[model samples]
Structure formats: C-alpha cells, structure tokens
Target: MYKLGYRNNNCIGCVKGGAGYWNKIRVDFPEVFKQRCKQSRAIGARLVRDSNGNRIFLDELSPDAGKYPDEPDFQCGFMCEIISKENNL
Candidate 1:
C-alpha cells in the first residue's frame, strides 16, 4: 500500500475499519470507496457500525466521525507465512 501512496497494508476498504478510516478513504480514494459501498449494498453486507448498533454503509460515514486509534505495524507476504500450522487447523 505504501507503494501506492497509502501508508497501511489494509485492504482498499477494510471491513474492520472505523468511521475515521472510512472517511479518510472517501477523501483519498473516492472511486475505490464508492465501489466498496455499492458492492456492500448489493450483497446486503456493510463494513461500518453506527452508535445505535445499526449498520453504517461506507458511503454514510460522517465527516468527523472519530479519530483512528494508533496501532503497531506488521508485514505480510500474502502467503500464510505468519500463521502456524496449528492455527490453520
């Protein structure tokens, strides 16, 4: 992702992200964000959750939703190299 100007390796629009992350995607990669929103609706699945425990579509996140919590960095080779054989089972 850093190669494409994105600082993290998270998916284009990771489902685990919070409002702050979604909002950032809206500003930085509007097209990709839009695609995820549309696809999510078509499949009846959403990546965001609102304060009321309701699903908040990617397109509906508020501008100042919240701040992204700091996290440690990890690397993945796209191979399950980081996982253990026991965990895979």
Candidate 2:
C-alpha cells in the first residue's frame, strides 16, 4: 500500500476505517468491504461519521465522503516524548 500512498498497511476492512478507506477497500477488496457492510449492519454498528459527526453505517457511507488515511509522520526523533528512549537501552 506504500505505492498506493497509504502510510500504514492497514488490515482490510478494519472496523476503525473511515469512509474513504472503506471506499478504497471497495475497489481494492470488494469482498471484504461487502462482508464488513453486511456484518456491521447486522450488528447495528456504525463505523463512520458524517460531515456532521453522526455515526453512519458503512453501506450508507457516501461514495464522496471522507479522504484516505494520511501517511502518519513518524519523524519525531527529538519531539516524541511519549516513550522514553533517552536511556538508549
């Protein structure tokens, strides 16, 4: 997926995926997307948020909704303090 501009190789049909991710999944992995839609709907689980922040079902997601996940910038050599690597263990 790096060649496809995806920062991380996210699992197909990940529940946390947004509409754009699902839309892309619909193209790259249609079967997975379809299965997710059916399953999520059956469980009444809305995995995407609308422009107004209302959670919506995957199948109900607009084709025009959302953008692909961003390539996260992991260049926090001196900025990230969440983990203490200063010890350089």
Candidate 3:
C-alpha cells in the first residue's frame, strides 16, 4: 500500500476501518474493496467483527453503516523498521 501512495501498511479495506472509512473506500477504491472481499471469501474469513459478534464480511458491509476506526494522525518510519527490529537488525 505504501508503494501505491498510502502512507502506512494498513491492508486494503482494513477490517479495523469503521463504517465511514469503509464507505469512503467503497466510493474511492471500490476495486480494492471488491478484491479484499474476494480474498476474504477464498480464505473463509472476514475482516470485520460487528458488535453483535458476527463476522461481517466486507461484501456484506453496508456502505452507509460503520464508523471510521481511529488511527494515529502522523506517519514517519518505514515498514523496514519493524522487519529490522524483528530480525535484530
């Protein structure tokens, strides 16, 4: 995603994203959302866990429902930092 212009490594249609975020993704990056849904089904998993304890697949999410998940407002550091730390680099 960083290579695609996103600042962070968050997955496409991140499960953590709330309704507003997903809605925006649905509007702005429909193809990504669709692909994520397809991949999720292939893996037999969904990204979203609803309050009702139901696994709400991305395909089943209501475009108008869901709240944007809170995220840090700043970005710096590359994903390599995490990889290096794990490898004791």
Candidate 4:
C-alpha cells in the first residue's frame, strides 16, 4: 500500500508536492511528467489544496487513483532516485 504524509505546503504522498522532488523529476525526466500531466488533464484533474493546506492532485485521494510511482517508468525512476538521494526514501 502507498503511505501518505505531508511536508510543508506539500503533500508528501503526491508527486505534485515538493519543488526539489518535482523539479528533479521534471528536469531529469521531462517526458514522464509531461505524459503524466497529459493523462491528468485528460481526466480533468488539478493540483488542489487539501484540508491540510498541502497541494495534491484530487485524483490521488481516490482509492482507485494512481500512485506517483505508478506513473510512467521514467517518472518512477526519477522519483525513486531523487527520494533516495534526498534520503526521503
């Protein structure tokens, strides 16, 4: 199961959080974030503020929603690598 948490104004459980995390993911893997955004936009999803004041994609709250790691392989690779690099893994 995917564990969820919060960090600052970010939802730790969602890839839309963490500038360093998302930036690295985008910089190192633009294609992945792009594709993921395409899919997200297709579903009319947006990065919304949760009750905790953290930003997270609305779809992420759904039980059937996709996890960050469940994104494209390149995106997953970047997330895992960056998380490990930042010692957040």
Candidate 5:
C-alpha cells in the first residue's frame, strides 16, 4: 500500500501517492531524491510524465508498442528534475 499527503503551493494542491509522495521529499531534500532515482534506475524501472502532467511508470520501453514495464533509467530523473524545477519545487 502507498501513503498520500497534501502539499499546497500557490493555491494549488498536490497529492502524493506511491512514489509520487517522494516528490515532497524531493523538494525538502534533493540529494535523497537523486539517490533514490539512481537506485530505481539501476533496477530497470523509470518514472515518467505524460502530457497531462501526470507521472508515468516505466519498467521497459518497447518499439513494438506492447504492454511492458519500462526501464527506470530511461531518463526519468531528468524529466522529474525538469518538472520539479519548472514547477518551482
């Protein structure tokens, strides 16, 4: 099971769930987030974001477009960092 938390900034509310909860920690503590991302990537899982600004989980990426887990090292940290920074986290 995952835990959830609410973070308010600029009148917007952010709900944390699963790894998403880590975002709060990531803001309060960045080094930890980097380490976690590194570890997750090493294990072949990745965090991604969609056009809707939602985080996407990837265990593997396939050119065939079939359902499969995406690799964690597949540039998740980079995207996460970008989003976090852009969003002023």
Candidate 6:
C-alpha cells in the first residue's frame, strides 16, 4: 500500500477510509469494493460522513465525491487519540 501511495496498510475498504480512498479501492479491487458496499448495506454501517456531517453509505457515494490524494493524507482518529492519551502525549 505504501508503494501504492497509501500511508498505512489497512484492509481494502477499511471503514476509516474516505470516499477518495474507497473510490481508489473500487478501481484497484473491484470485488472487495463491491463486497464492502454490500456489507455496509446489510449491516447499516456507514463508513463515512459528508462535508455536512451526514453519514453516507459506500454505495451512495459518488465516483466524483471526494478528492483523490496524490500523496497519503492520514488523519488521526479516536484510536490514535486513545493511544496518545495512554502514552501521555
């Protein structure tokens, strides 16, 4: 994934990923992308929110929705926050 310009080797269709990342997955790994959409629908788990903060399912995301990063742009999430707190950051 680093070779592909991803900062982390998270699973394809990782829930932490943004629409741009998912769209990249949709192209590079069609089956995995399809599976994620199907699974999200079945489980009612939206992996991302819009600029308006509305939860959005993968299937509902547009191919043109988000910006595709030319370089990895990782943002720290809750897990990172927890780890930082544990480390007294």
Provide the overall lDDT of each model, using Cα atoms, as 2-decimal numbers. 0.67, 0.73, 0.65, 0.46, 0.41, 0.79
Across residues 17-59, which tens digit of lDDT does each residue of candidate 1 receive? 6676677777788898889889888887877767676887776
RMSD of 4: 13.1
lDDT of 2 by residue, 7-43 (tens): 5564556675677777878888889989999999999
- The positional error of residue 71 in candidate 1, measured at the CA in angstroms, is 8.1
- Give the count of colliding residue pairs in each prediction: 0, 0, 3, 0, 10, 0
Top of the candidates by TM-score = 6
Q: Model 4, range 7-88, lDDT digits (tens) per residue? A: 2323223444433344334544567656655666687666544446565553343323334343332224566667777986
8: Cα error in model 2, Å = 1.6
Q: Model 1: what TM-score?
A: 0.63
Angstrom error at residue 83, model 3: 8.5
- lDDT, candidate 6, 1-89, per-residue tens: 77876767655567778878888888888899999999999999998667687899998888876666753466667886786689786
- The candidate scoring highest on lDDT is 6
Give the candidate order by descending lDDT.
6, 2, 1, 3, 4, 5
lDDT of 4 at 41: 66
Candidate 3 ranges beyond 4 A from true positions = 1-11, 69-89
The residue pairs found clashing in candidate 6 are: none
How many clashes in candidate 4?
A: 0
Q: Provide the global lDDT of candidate 1 against the true structure.
A: 0.67
Model 3 / residue 88 / CA error / Å? 20
RMSD of 1: 6.4
TM-score of each: 0.63, 0.69, 0.57, 0.34, 0.33, 0.70
Off by over 4 Å in 4: 1-16, 48-89
Could you arrange the candidates by TM-score from highest to lowest?
A: 6, 2, 1, 3, 4, 5
Q: Model 1: which ten-residue window has the lowest total lDDT?
A: 71-80
C-alpha-based local distance difference test score of model 3: 0.65
